[model samples]
Target: MSPTIEAISAMPNGEKPTYLLVMLHGWGANYQDFVPFAKMLNFPGFGYFFPNAPFEHFQVPGGRAWYALEENEFTGLATSRKLLLNWLTSLEASTGVPLDRTVMAGFSQGGAMTLDVGLTLPLAAICSFSGYLHYQPEFQDNKTFPPTMIIHGQQDPVVPIEAAKKAQDELTKIGVSVQYQEFMMGHEVQDPAIALFKQFIQDNLNFN
Candidate 1:
């Protein structure tokens, strides 16, 4: 069976969609986490897809997680990446949008996954919020860079600001065109971050 996916799509009254944005949610959250923000975006000809993580988070009832978070285990990260990739492939098959016209954006853990999948896939852009790139060193020899925007909170306790900075530095070292922004908040996404996200999409997607 195909993976479960929840999506919201918008197109100008007469025009076909030219771009697609995939929003991946943070840990312990479901597809609904991005619905409100997706609605706030002003991409008239862009279609949006928000897919729920494959696993259920232990701590939060009725909440989903990309993978299980266990001590000394990075399996969750790998699992999430594969599942997301599968979902993206299925979405492309159904929507008829080429991978080059697709963008992936995520928050927190989802942000990390966005970086992982975006780098490995042939995507146009990636936007990450409250997240960091953890596997930059591995991609050094691969030398594939996607236009990426990273937004983090200066006071984020879950993922430290220092870690985010380090991730930016590593990506820059490898010639990745990365745009980094920080907000005066915590682990949550703030208005400034959202504004930057909007601008990043508009600039990269060429939405008039």
Candidate 2:
């Protein structure tokens, strides 16, 4: 059976999409949470897809998460990875955007999911903001990986800046080219981070 996904999309200049940017939202947030940010990063000749998580948040009404926060995060991550991959495949089929021209990105838990699934796929680039690697042994092997960038706030009380550092080290150990940046903010993607992300996209992915 095909997976059902609900998302918000924005096309560059209202023209046919040449590339895809998949943005995932953090826990306790809905798909639309990232729509504005996606638009800020929207470059010409690229399309954006902001997909809602499959499960509803336990506490926040109208909020969603890729998986339950109360459960083992690794288990949840594994399950979310499968569901996201399936949805991505169906989306590609429907949109006619090849997987190679796609970039995956997210913030916080969404950022964590980006690392979880994006690294495993044949995507052009990956970006993480306030995200962590979630540290799996299997993902730490030498291979040609998609170019990746991670941005985190140094004062982030929720995820901590160390998570991004660890991710950078592990990705480097695995021979993945990675760029790491830190901001002075707390648990947020600030303007500077977005600027860096925009540059990361232009450097690593092709939109024109």
Candidate 3:
């Protein structure tokens, strides 16, 4: 089955957005988890969309998961990728936001998905926090690599720091432009990450 997506848009009254930021959440979390972060960024005049994962998590109540994880491997990554691609197409069709003006951001598992999916799809930029590269083979064959930013905590237990390095190395090897930063926190997006995110969007998107 295809993943279900829910979008939360914030556009100031009388303002039409030239760019859109799509937020994806980590495993066992839904779109609502990103509400606080979205409001905190407060990117005035930009459209924000937070999409819920399709599947219900095994243990978490009312929680959704993009795909199942087995050990370090996301078991259904391929399926999730197809679902997200279709979701992106649907969002564009419904909102009329061009793909070139769309950016993707996520945390942890969601971050991994953003990197994996964003690289293959045409996008303006991608920001990942506390996420790593999964399904490297898929990325190796992909031709389009959007401007990418990856931020991770040095002490992240859920996704190791080394994973972030490996992702950076792989993307670099494949000639994907990447800006990576390490923070002092763990498995969470901090203020520094937010600052980077804002700058990344401003640099890549014509939102001013």
Candidate 4:
């Protein structure tokens, strides 16, 4: 696995983890941020990995960013994308979980990244919460994508709901099977969304 990004992981208690879940924190958040969040899911027998973004946040002390938000074209995005892709592709070797049984999900900027690299990989599924699509997609007409879940807050102030909708539209146009949801909240995860997320993972994972 690439040593470029630092990460933290956990295995289910009393059982051998049979699947892998990679959670990417949003901009300004560190790997530690998702530790408790993962617990909230109450998922069992699945290993969890939370990878720290490579770059430091320019404004928030002790916070990290996938890329800087200064340029009209997000600077650092390409670099982060490459590093994340490398790390994810190499992950199965270290975790004993193949990409076909792995799910890559994220929030905010990290969610943007979920779509960024997740679209290109043969992951079991990819999910984005309160996230947006960064680039104008240029996929082939017949390309197939993993099962995707896009969730956003109807009253979100940070990332407008429209961005999520636009992402849904674009992805659908490309023949991606997407399950989109709009919750009754803001720029944060809530109970209902968590339930949906859990179900989504269970439904897509190749577990008998």
Q: Candidate 3: which pairs clash?
A: none
TM-score of 4: 0.94
Cα TM-score of candidate 3: 0.90
What TM-scores do the predictions have? 0.88, 0.90, 0.90, 0.94
- lDDT-based ranking, best first? 4, 2, 3, 1
RMSD of 1: 2.6
Stretches off by above 4 angstroms in model 1 are: 1-16, 139-142
What is candidate 4's lDDT per residue for 129-160, written digit by digit as tens?
99999988876966888999999999999999
> Model 3 segments beyond 4 Å from truth?
1-3, 71-73, 137-142, 206-208
Give Cα-based local distance difference scores for all models: 0.78, 0.82, 0.82, 0.89
lDDT of 2: 0.82
How far in Å is the alpha carbon of 74 misplaced in model 4? 1.2
Please give the distance, in angstroms, between residue 195's alpha carbon in candidate 3 and its true position after superposition: 0.7
Q: Whole-model lDDT for model 4 versus the true structure? A: 0.89
